[model samples]
Target: MNSEGGKVVCVTGASGYVASWIVKLLLLRGYTVRATVRNPSDTAKTEHLLALEGAKERLKVFKADLLEEFSFEQAIQGCDAVFHTASPVKFTVMDPQTELIDPAVKGTIDVLDTCRKISSVKRVILTSSMAAVLIRQPPLEPNDVVDETFFSDPSVCIESKLWYQLSKTLAENVAWQFAKDNGMDMVVINPGYIIGPLLLPTLNLSVEIIVDMVKGKNPLNCRYYRFVDVRDVALAHVKALESPSANGRYIISGQSVTINHIKETMRELFPDLCIDDMNGEGLMDGINCTMCVDKVKNLGVEFTPLKSSLRDTIISLKEKCLL
Candidate 1:
């Protein structure tokens, strides 16, 4: 790991929408990034990142899988920082523990184990989800927002079919526990519904929801919930990496609004657009559900307005022919 100028930082799931943005921002800032993808041979998955600004000299792609041990060592070798952003997120899995929990928890441990053996690795930035924090506590404290101190009890997070929340909560808890047990330096970023264009057309679980909503494929009969821009989420990841004082967890979300909030915003912003109204459950087009961003803002993150995010998302979908 290079602690001096232009330290190399490893980003897991480098081809993912959020991780790709993190890679992009790192390259723009002149930091060397070692990006890991499951398949190095898939040029389609990584070409956008290579074409990004400053990517030629600043980015390197490594083939790594979350299912394998020692796979991340080569990618993280000689890097001062690590960003673990790879996790499986699905609404319904026949076996939640196997399909979601195993990789989420085990992959984190594997990466940390690699870091423990490498003295050069000094810090770890984990990309968790707000579902790990907000889904459990029904009556959220109006004034007291979720911070690093808050956690979603896995046992109580079964209201939604999205078992991915349970996996994330468990994985984050394991990260903290491992950090404490091994005396490793680590920080976690729990972002709300992330919305933005992908570096590539491929979808990771987080961005897939927004894409599906725009495409009128939302199966969840829910009301609205908080959302954040992928750009802001990427910025937060890099910020957490550089800020020495940033330790523990930070909630990163855009403005709060329900499904209706998104629909109305899009309707006003782009009158020609035909956005479908999903008759979902919790945050259906009728309610207002949002989150407080004091934590990440304190770390110097600026969130994009929800309207802008929705507009950009539609544009992205159109460009990708997903619309």
Candidate 2:
């Protein structure tokens, strides 16, 4: 272990889709991780994390709840950094308030509450989404490419019935306000539609897009969206932690492609899959991606290419027998 180089850090939701990769990289980089999960004894939920390289020597797991105040205090005690990545992610739930908004917004406040009590903590890295920054509805012009400065209009999100995006926007808004008011050192990584090799066997909404594509779902190839690789997203979190200048929000993304473009790549890679291609010429007024990634690039983080991200996602799904 690089004890001199490593710092003890706490990661909330360590078994999560993106958080798993963050914990893996932290362990790989010699950082001792204090990981929090809903149920520590659930082997199926934590086995992938336990199998990582330095987990035995340096990783510790604890139970914490997003709603319970001070639930993270024990796990965060004495840690140098905290990565608060826990949030409920159901979009089609019967109750958006209980399933999405409360968890997203209130959970952030709960974590910040813990941070305020932990004097040993120096910096916090938040896993925010592009939804916090980009307006989903579009008659977007080419110049609509956004950066950290852009914030999605919460009203617009609600008007469009995009509960998930609104949840993220509100949650991130709370985080930024709390951080500023309390003088907390924080950085936000707003990633595009995240997709890559998931460490956990559980399905992620982003990876579901890949599965839908492989199964030749027509709607999957009917629109355009921006995407970033999960591996790149993980590295960005580490970079934000280590880089002194990485203070504000940074957008991490790779090239944006139409769904048709993605389907073409999938067709070439998995020739046996039944797939159809559409030009998607008029799809949402050519809104490939309404964001820019130059800010994150300035931090020396390179995103994985779109093709590679898709290919890896497919391979992972096949390995799990999900495709």
Q: What is the TM-score of each candidate against the true structure?
A: 0.90, 0.93
lDDT of each: 0.80, 0.83
Compose the digit string of candidate 1's lDDT tens values, residues 1-323: 22358888999988887888888888888888899988888898788878989888788889988889999999999988999998877777899878998999999999999999999988999999887886555546445455556678777776556588889988998999999999999989988778877678765566667666655555345554667899999989888888888878888866555566666777787778666776554434422334557878988888787777878887887788766
Cα deviation at 241, candidate 2, in Å, is: 0.3
lDDT of 2 by residue, 1-323 (tens): 12355699999989999999999999999999999999999996799999999999999999998878788899999988899989877668777788899988888999887888889888999998877877655535676777788888888888878788889999999999999999999999898778899889778888887777666564434466667889888989988988888889988866666677788898888888777544445545334545677888888788787888888988898888777
Number of the top lDDT candidate: 2
For model 1 the local lDDT of residue 72 reads 96
Candidate 2 is scored at a TM of 0.93
Clashes of 1: 16
